[model samples]
Target: MTALADQTRWLDATAQAALVRSGEVKASELVEAAIERIERLDPGLGAVTLRYFDQARSAAADGSNGPLAGVPFLVKDLLTDVRGQACTDANVALKAQARPADADSPLVARFRAAGLVLAGRTASSEFGTTPTAESAAWGATRNPWNTALSSGGSSGGSAAAVAAGMVPAAHGTDAAGSIRIPASCCGLVGLKPSRSGARTAVESVMDLIVPSVLTRSVRDTALFLDIARGDEGPAPADGYLAEPGKDPGRLRIGLLDTRIDGSPVHPDCAQAARSAARLLESLGHHVDPGFPAALGDSTLDQLFAAFWSAGMGDLLADVARRLGRDVTASDVEPLNWALGTLAADLSADDRQAASEGVAGFARSVVSWWDDRDLLLTPTQAEPPLPSGTLASDPAEPMAPLLRSTQFAPFTPFVNFTGQPAISLPLHTDTAGLPIGVQLVAAPGREDLLLRVAAQLEAAAPWGERRPGL
Candidate 1:
């Protein structure tokens, strides 16, 4: 592979685009650099499961130009489909019967319009039901920070790819913290925009999943948001690029180190939040030790479990239809089988009750925003654990799943509330794994989150850090 430039592989998407736009580097050159990096590094990490290198090179050579012309990007393998690529959700059944998406999903279409060269698809959990990115089909995507550790799921492949310098930024989706969890585990910025302004082709289970990207810099995240927020125009026509680095005046920020479900947070994760709180205070924002009264209840967890199980059933049915065969327990992980089986037992009344419960919780949680401009919490309750921490067994599947996520009880609430939240890699633990801090904003107020995140990024810059390659 020809040398592109110093650290070309690590440059953010915005910088890569600038090089292409200025003709300092050809789009084809940038595309080759990414493909080269992926080829060189992906074997150790297993972040990318499918490659579209020839097509990407063809697109780059065509000069189909836009703001992000020639920037290399990967889509999470689950829901965000790219034309002529496998859209497996990391299930063996789907992987064995893979088919190219006939056309780009609307969000993928926007990425193409912005001039991103689609290079590959990243790994994700089966049906995106778990937080770790291991799959029977693609194996586990290892963290770049420490190879033995896992890259978090279901957006783990994208986060790991970006973290490993294979790409500047990659598409990720957040439903109950898929994007943010992996961002935390792999040390990248992951944003889940509010339902009002977020991009979507079709809503996933509970309509909680929001499409976004994982990047190394806040500016890259902002720019990608500008590109991904579809043409529907619920957001300002000017886009979100202007929000970062702009002064966000003193605002009310409620801090929650403790999870709402009364789950125990790792001390390192709690310290990460408290450290961010102090930093925000220094930056002139009022940080208080209070959260929504609606949080810390058992009902939210129960409701989420029910809704997720029902969604699993729906996903199984759809997968069966697509494969033209029944997806048996052996076709997927044990956890998925257990969840799908539970979903089969769900009555319509059970689904309705779960929906109602979530709606009620959302009302109470959103009401907290009336008293505060933002909510700050730990992105995950712990540092990146070794691979298979969230693995499942057919005999006792839920145990591992729930045990692995006790540190992340704060994220799912935001998903259910349909509010925007961003995970910033603001702190590190004793062993030096990245710990992300989540900042949540009211619905349709990503502008506020971006501004504050920019402030944090400046006050404690994380740009120079890199994983052990």
Candidate 2:
């Protein structure tokens, strides 16, 4: 790679855009640098699954118009539909299928409209069913910080690429903590925008999955949101990027260090949370140990599990039918098989109860947020696990796999509530693994979250620290 590429590779998207816009560097030069990094690093990381170098190069040469004029980005393999891109969702059953999409998905279109270059698609778990990025088709995605440890999933591939400087930012989706978990593990800023911020068409059969970006800096994420949340009509009262740096002004920040389901948080993870609380207090924000009253009910866990299982079952069945094959336990991961079985047993009344319960829980949580500006917690209950720890052999029983993966208790609740949350790289353990602190806000209050996150970033800068890479 050229010296220009080397310097620009680690720069945040906003900085890179500024460089390009000022003609200090060309977009093609940046794209070439990104492609070089992907070629050199992705062999060992296995983060990138598909390449669009030719397309990206052509678009960069064409000189697209927008704010992010030459920034290279990757899409998570799960939700995006890039033209001529083969999306496997990292499942072996669908490996043979590669088709052209007629047009960019709304989110992709927005990225293109912003002049961001789409480099390729990143790896993900089968149908994004698992939290770890161990795919039956692709090998495990190793953390850039330490290859032996995991890069959390199903957005693991995107997180790894961004952390390794292969791309400035990449897209990720959170169905059940997919985005935040990986971002925390890889030491990137990950925000799961509210379901309303999602650009894809909603499917009635499944629970809502919010799509978002993972970036090295808060401003890049804010910029991407500004572009992605296009003029679908009039902007929200708190417009995108309207006041990202505006002072939140002595906010009441609730700190929840304990797990919601009565499980214990790992020591290192707890310390990270405490450190974040202290930082907030030092910044003149009121930080107190508090719990969300709505999450105190154990029944919510049962409902969340049922809804997630049901949604997975529906997606798997649809994929199987589309491929002209009979869906069977042997064809999928063990946890998915167990989920399918549970889904089959769920009656309409059971599903209705789950939906109503989750909705009520969301209302309660949002009501509490009206009193507090943000809720701070650990992004995961523990640090990143050793690679393959969350992996399940198709031959094994599924119950153990599910229990083993629940070490991450802090991320799924926001998905369940459809609230906006961010995972910030605030602390690192003695072993040098990054531990993320989560900042959650009320629904549609992403602007507030971003401003506070920028303040926190200034308070504790993480940009200079790079994973071993």
Best by lDDT, which number? 1
Off by over 4 Å in 1: 197-206, 234-237, 261-264
For each of the candidates, the C-alpha root-mean-square deviation to the true structure, in angstroms, is 2.4, 2.7
Error of 2 at 363 (Å): 2.2
lDDT of 1: 0.85
Return the TM-score for each candidate structure. 0.96, 0.94
Q: Residues 1-469, candidate 2: write the lDDT tens digits.
A: 6687578778988888888899998999989999999998999899998899999999899987688898998998875777667677776666655555677789888888888999999988777877778777787999999998889988999999999999999999887788899999999999988877332233233457778899999888877777777885333234565555788789998998878755679988889899999998998999997768987786676877777767877878886875688876656767777777888888888877777777777777678887888999999888888898877665664643465446677777677677889999999999788999999988778878888888889999999989866
Clashing pairs in 2: none
Tens digit of lDDT per residue, candidate 1, span 419-461?
Answer: 9999999999887889999999988898999999999999999
Q: Which stretches of candidate 2 lie over 4 Å from their true place?
A: 197-205, 233-238, 261-263
